[model samples]
Target: MKVMIRKDSKGTLSAYVPKKDLEEPIVSIARPQMWGGLVTLANGWRLELPEMAADTALPITVEARRVAGGED
Candidate 1:
């Protein structure tokens, strides 16, 4: 529902968090509980998405917009 964010020295995505309050890290609103998905790496150190998420996002985006009255 919300995001708490910070960037590392090299501009990589260090964390993507959502929480009730900031102080931070200890609080989580979009905690791993609801946002669970497969996480992998493109080069072992870099991050990649699992096949399911990779395959699902685009169609799901369309479906969500349709439900939201934003798409046909």
Candidate 2:
């Protein structure tokens, strides 16, 4: 699925799923840089993000895999 990753003004990380019309704050990250790892959303969905540069810009949309979550 496609997920938009962004940082809010308060520096909180969030993920927005366009197809689902759902947005949730990222509660945990499997890796410090957050790339090539898993991120858990506040709603309990786990998504695997692709590898990217450590300095990759935010608010960017990228392809991600839904590792664990509810329907779709």
Question: For this target, which candidate reaches the highest lDDT against the unseen true structure?
Answer: 2
Give the least accurate 10-residue stretch of model 2, judged by summed lDDT.
63-72
**What does candidate 2 score in Cα RMSD to the true structure?**
1.6
After superposing candidate 1 on the true structure, give the runs of residues whose Cα lies further than 4 Å from its correct spot: 18-72
Model 2 lDDT per residue over 1-72, tens place: 999999999999999999999999999998888999999999889999999999999999999999956334
- Which clashing pairs does model 1 show? 18-29, 19-29
Listed in order, each prediction's TM-score against the native is 0.21, 0.93
Cα RMSD, model 1: 14.2
Model 2 residue 63 CA deviation (Å) reads 0.3
Taking every candidate in turn, the Cα RMSD to the unseen true structure, in Å, is 14.2, 1.6
lDDT of 1 at 1: 27
In model 2, how large is the Cα lDDT of residue 59? Answer: 91
In candidate 2, which residue ranges exceed 4 Å CA deviation? 69-72
Best by TM-score: 2
